[model samples]
Target: MSSAYKTSAVENTSKYGPFTKMVDVYGLKILGLGNVGGQPQVSTEFLNKTAETFKLLLDPNAAGINKKSREKALKGLTSYNVIQRVGVKAHITHTRQALIAAKYRAGTKSMTSIDQEQTSSGICDLMGGPTLLLEQAQITENLEHALHTITQFALPAAFPQEMNISSKNGKASGISGDLYKALREAIANGVYDDSDYSRQR
Candidate 1:
């Protein structure tokens, strides 16, 4: 996993696309760990493998490559894989925690801190957390690509609302009070995904 991410950084320097590099690094990391994660004794090995992979992805030197005419080719590759992996792990850990929570809900435990902590982690709550690993491995990286990747595939609910805001922004002041009002309404009504944009709101 570590070598895969390191090589991905080197390879992605010439491509200079965040979405593509994210998909590549993520796929490579997951694929490398897939077989190892299946074995009971090697479960911790898989986790360690992913951790080392993140370390290489976060390394400054390997990501500082310059293609004389291009932007920072390795820019988005940093932290993206690590954070995504963190999200995936949190999903797994919280799933187990949810079982613990359920037992508490069933009166198995006097307190529910384990389950409450599981509830606070966002990943496990998304679509019940079952599909989170696949989504993280597959669709999540496309967010940085063309909007169609998000609109048509990764996020459908966000696009129509985004179009609504965009249409209102064509006026004299651009993004008028009506747009703000609509945005606030959308946010208050919980129409957006829990993305960075949503957090900023």
Candidate 2:
């Protein structure tokens, strides 16, 4: 019955097509007949404006380039895997916001001053916060530890085979042959540094 609830219901219906019935069992007219089963309409001019807005957001300095070229570049960038990663990060941020809201409502945790300040500043959404930072740092540390573990296991298994190949006619074999040849050439040319050898050992 609240304005907020009505607004949310309308928005939800707009996203998906409208429902079959306009009124619920309570005999209250929720949606008009015209709106029922109707898809949201988007204008071509509106789409063009949106594309221009995003182009400016992505590359503000692209003033010299024409609109079509800028749009083409923007399309290519959006098609890349980086856009998928951005979508994933956005989803995670939204999920965190929902969890924080639930915790605040349940009185389980106090909302931070930063969150209150952000809300007061007319920013209703809390995307990146301390939680996001902690998550990113934890992921980075885990990745570094995994890489270290993998290298530790791989090098001992690979070193003896490489040594055997290098000792035979000074020719390296297998997938690492090119890398081995480059290293030997660098050492022969006195370009290979041994300063880190002691540290590595």
lDDT of 2 by residue, 58-109 (tens): 3425657454543433333222211100012213344344434433221121
- Per lDDT, the best of the predicted structures is 1
Residue 178 alpha-carbon offset, candidate 1, angstroms: 24
lDDT of candidate 1 over 136-184, digit per residue (tens): 5333322222222212221222233333323344553354344456766
- Error of model 1, residue 124, in angstroms: 18
In model 2, which range of ten residues has the least summed lDDT?
A: 110-119
lDDT of each: 0.30, 0.29
The deviation in Å at residue 155 for candidate 1 is 25
TM-scores for candidates 1 onward, in order: 0.21, 0.18
RMSD to native for every prediction? 15.8, 21.0
